[model samples]
Target: MRARSHSPRKPKPNSVMGSPKMKSKSKSPQKKHRAVINQLDYLNSQCHMEGCSVSIVVHSTRFLICRHQLCHASDYFKDLLQSKYGSEDFYVTVSSMSEPTPSTQFRWFVESSIPCPALKDISDETLETCMRLSRRFDAKGLEMRCTKFIVENACSRQPIVALCWLNWALKHKFDAQTQASCLPSVARLSLTALEQHRHMLTEKIFSDLLAAKLRGTYDKAVQVFRAIHRMDHFSVEVDRCPRCGRTRDGMRVKVNADPCRKQIGCDRCHRESCEIENKAGDDLQAFYQCPHGLVPLNSTTDECHCQIPNLAHHLGSRYYFRSENGTILNPPPLSPHTSRTFDPAEDTSERPGTSYKRQTSRDMDRREQRQSAVVVRLEMLVVSLQPEESVRRAEIVSFGSSVILSIAFFYIFTMLNAFTTTNIALLDKSSGCFEKKISKYYGQPKKLWERFSRAVSLCSPRLHSVELGAFANTDEFKVPLLAPSEDCVVLSLGIGKDVKAERRMRDRMSQCVFIGADPVNESNADLFSQVGKFYNVAVGHKNGSFRSYVLEDVYRYQEVAYMDLATFIKLNVNRKIVDQMMMDVEHAEYPVLPFLEKGGELSQRDIAINIEIHRPTSEDLQAFVGFLRRNSLSQQWIFINSEIHPFFKHIRLFMINGQNKECRRRFWEN
Candidate 1:
C-alpha cells in the first residue's frame, strides 16, 4: 500500500468554482429579481422602484414594478411572472387589475404588503371582495384578519351574513377553518330559522344542511333508544325477564268480597245499623285523608280487573312473526305500561309550541326500536368502558362484528343451497349413484366404528327432523318413483367446466330433451357446447341478472352472470313437466327452492331436482330437507366424497310430489 496525500484537487480554468466541494454563487435573473423584490416597499409611488421591467396595469393606470416585487406575494404570481416572458429585457404585463370586480380587490391586496388600514370601515361588499382577493392570492394573514373581523362583527350581529360568508367559502372551497367555524352554529339553527333563511342556502350549504339533519335524526333516534331502555317498561316488545323467556299474563284474578251481612234480614243487624246511624249524628271527628286520593270502589265484577303485564315483561318471547306478505307483524298491546298514560290532550295543551310530529310519546315512531339491545347501545358501551379497555373493546367489537357477518353470510349461503342440493349420506351401492338418499342412522353407532359413528351422529338429518317433522322423510331416498326415459324433460343449471353429469344424463336418456345453463362465457364455451341447446345464463329463483361469486383455487373471487330459472324454463322448455332439473348454481339454491315452493310451481310439474350444494352444515341440510318434505316432496341426498374437495362438499337432492310413509325407516331395539 502507498501513502496518499490529503490535499484537495486543483480547479480548472473553465470552472468558476475551485472544486465540486467549493460553494459558488450562480446568479440567474430570477435570483437577482428575487433579491431586489425581497426589499420592503416603503414608498407608494412607482418611481421608487427603479430599474423595474414589469408594469402592473390596474384599470388603465400603469405602475412600473420590479419583476421580483410582483412575484413576492405568492408562488402563483412568481410562477406566472417568470413563465409569462422568459426574456429579462421585455416588460411583463399583470392583467388581474384590469377586471372591474377584482380591480379594487387587487389594489387592496397589493397595498396589504405594507401594514395599513385599507380594509377598515369598509362596506360588507368591499370586505367580501377583499376577502375573495386574499383567498385567490392565498394571503393567509389577510384572509385570517378578514375572517376574524367578519366572524366577530358581521357574523355575530347578523347570522344570515355568517351563512352568506359560509356559503361563499364553501362555493369557492376557501379556508377550512372559516367554513368549519360556521358549521356548528349553522347546524344548531332551528327549523324556523332555516326556513326564514332558506334562500341564503346554496347547493353546497343545502347538502351540508341535509347531512346535518340526517346526523341529528340519527342522534335523536339513539337518544330515544337510550331513554326508552331506562324506563321501567317500553312500548317495544323487548321488556322480558333476562333469566327466563316467559311473560306474566297481564290480567290477575280478583276474589269476590264476602256476601254483605247487612243483606240478611236479622233484627240484630237492623238494631246495629240504627245504633251506628245514631252514633254518627252524635260524634264528628276529623279523619286522615289518603295521599293518593280516594279511589272509586268497583261495584261490578267486570270493573274489578287487575293490571296486565307489559310486553317488556317477555324478554325472550318471539313476538315478531312474518306474515304471508313477508311483513314482520309484532302486535303488542296498544297501551304501554308507563307510570303515566299518554294523554294526548294534556300533552298537546302543555307543549303548545311543539308540533304533533315532534311528540316523542307517539308509539308509531318507536316501533323500529324493538329488540335494539341485548344489553345497551354501542355509545353507552363505549362510555362505560375504561380507557385501557376501550382499545380491547374496539378490537373485540371489530373481530366480533367480522365473525357475526361471516356467520350470517354462511347461514345465508346455506339457506340458498337448501332446495338445490341432494343428500346421499345413506345411499349405498345398491342405490343408483344418481339417486338421492337420506341417512338411516336411527341406531347409536359403536365407538369402534368411527366413520359410521361420526356419520350417524353428525351427518344424520334426524337431529333437526324433530323440529320439522312434517317435512322430514319417513324413509331414505326409497320412494317408489320410476326412472325417467323418453318422456322426461331434463334441465340442469350451472353445469361445471367438466359437464360430466349433463353428458351422462343425456347419453342415458337418449329420447329425453336436455337443456343446460352456465354463464362462464369464455372458458367453458367448449364444455357447454357439448350439451344439447345450452344457454349462457345462470339460474336463480327470479328473472334478473344476478352476480355469481366464484371462489377460485387461487384464493380470489370471480363474478359471473346469473339468470332467473323460471323465466329460462318458460322460454326454453316446451314440455309442461320437467322430469328432473339438476341445479348447481352454487349458493343460489336458497332463493330458487323457496321461489318454487312459494309459488306452488313445484306442484305444477313432476320435477326431480338433483342440485349440488356448496358447504352446507347438518343444520342447513336438515332445514333444506324439511323444506322439501313441507312441500309434500320426497327428498334424498347424496353426500360429496371428502376426497374430491378438502373443505367444500356438494349434495345431490331429489324431490318428488308424493310421500312414502310405509317405507319409513325406524330403529327397533335389537
Candidate 2:
C-alpha cells in the first residue's frame, strides 16, 4: 500500500515526468474517465515525497475522486478536495473543445518531522534574537525574530526571499509592535491577496510551550515547562551542617539593650526576646554593648553576651536572672554554693612600660595622671562547707522569706478564689480603654470547661480586643472580620448593574469618589474622602463593554471581590495582594476563573471570594465550586435569589481571607 512497496523499481528519466494517457475521441464516457484515472495514478506515482518521482501535477481527464483512491498522494488529494468542497457533489460536463484552462501549481508543505529537527538545531542566540524581536517596536526589524535571524545569517544576497520569510514569520506570533510598525507597508498589499495564501510559515516555529502560551493554556504551559527541564528529577535536601550537624535554627536578629539591666530585646518584635544575635558590632568581647547601647551576640548563657540582665526581661511574664557569685544564689548555703563554683581566670597583666610611655606621649600631665591611676579589687569571702548549721542558716535567710511569701500567697489565693470572676470583670472594665470588652467565667473542672471554654463571643471590624489577649495562644487566634491594618484596608465594589446593591455599598462608603466609564481619573485625596471612606471604581472599562482593564493600584488593597467579568481582571487582581476576591465577573465567571488559574502566573487564589453563580450545567457548576475549593477558596454560596438565570443562585456569602487549614482544604481541594 506504501510507495516503498516498489522503491527498488527506479523510474526512467522519461518516466519520471510521466506522459499523460491519450483517449480516443469517440470513446464512451466510462472508458475516457477510466483512462484519465490511470494517467492520474501515474502522475501521482512520479511525485512521491522525495524519490523516484517528480513534484508536479500532470494534465489529465481523470475523475479526481477515483483517481485519488489509487494515487500515491491520495491522502493529500483528499484533504485538498474536502477543503475546496464541503461535502456537496456536482458532476462536471467535459467537452473536447475548451476556451481556456486554469493554471494549477504545486506547493510543498514542510512536514513536522523536518521542522522539528531544524528547530532543534536552532542556537540559543537565535532564540534570544527571537525573544528580543518579539518585544521590539521597530520596522526595519519588523520580521519574526527567527525569520529575521535566518535571513541575516543565511542570505548573502536575495534580500527579497528574506522579506518573503518575514511575511511567513508573522503568523508565528509576530511582535505586535513589529506588525503595528510595518502596517504602513502592508497597506499597499491587497487584503484579499494577503488572505489568498499565508504559507503557514510561522506554524513551524512554535514549540509546544509557546503554543500553549498563545492558547492561554496555563496548566498545560506549566506541564510543558516540566517536560523541558525535568524539574521533578531534582529536589532540595537540607544541608547537614558541618559542625555538630545539629541543624541549628540559624537566622539574624538585631538587639536593642536595656540601659538599666543591659538586657537585649529583638529589634523586629520586642514582644518576645530572641536568643541568636549575628547583629553587627565591632568589639566581639563587648558584643552585648555598643557605645550606641545596642548589643547583639549569640551568648545567652546565665549572663547575656553584654554581661547584663536584659531590662526588657521585665516586659514579659517569664524572666531570667544570673548571680555574679554563685554563693549569692543560695545565701544561707554558701558552703554548698562554693562547692559548685569555679575560679575566674585572671586578666593578663597590662604591658607595663608600653602603657607608661604611651601615656607620656599623649597629654604629658594627663598621661602621667592616667599612668598613675589606681585599680580597685573587691575581695569576696568564701564560706567553709562545715555542717548542717550553714544549711540551716541558708534556710533561715533565703528560704525563710520564700516560705513567708508562699504562705501569704496561699492565704491570699484562698480568699480571692471566691472573687476571681468579680476581679476579672473589674479588670476588664478598668483596663479596656483601648480594647474591646472581655467576658469572664469561673475556671471550672476540665469536663465542665469543655462546654464553654472557648467561643467567638461576637465579631466586629476591630484590630484589638480583650478576648484576643486571653485567647492569644488559642486555636482561634486569627480573626476573620479583623483585617491587618487600617491603612491597608479597602471596601472595593465591582459596580456592574445591580444598582440597588451599588447604592447600598455607596452609603457604606459615601465619602469615596465614584469612577464610571469615561472615567475622570480623580485625585487621591478625593478618592478617599470620608473618615473610613472608600474608593468606588469600575475596573478597567469606562462603563459597559465586556472588555475589562487592570486596576494595578487596586491590588495594593489586600482584598478584592468581583461578581462577574473576564479572567485577566482576576489574574491582575491576584498578584502582589488580594487576600480575598469576590467573584461574579459578568456572565462569564465560571469558565473565566479556570482560565485565569490555568494560564496566568497564578498557582492559587488565596482570597475569600463569593460569586453569584452564573447559569451553568450542573456538572460545570459543581466542577467550578470544586475547583474553588481545590484552590483553597471557600464556596458557601447562598441562593437567596436568581432572576436573570434560574441556575444562577445568589447563595449565602462564604469567604475566607484568613481561616483555619480545614477551611483552606475545603475551599481549594487540589
Best by TM-score: 1
TM-score of 2: 0.19
Q: Give the Å shift of residue 410 in candidate 2.
A: 26
Give lDDT per model, in order: 0.48, 0.32
> In model 2, how large is the Cα lDDT of residue 665?
35
lDDT of 1 at 597: 60
Give Cα distance to truth, residue 628, candidate 1, Å. 5.2
Instruction: Tell me the deviation in Å of residue 254 in model 1.
Output: 99
Q: What's model 2's lDDT at 461?
A: 20
Error of 1 at 273 (Å): 99
TM-score of each candidate?
Answer: 0.26, 0.19
Per-residue accuracy of model 1 over 282-369 as CA lDDT, tens digit each:
1211122344343322211121112112332332222444334444445444433222222333343344465654565456435434
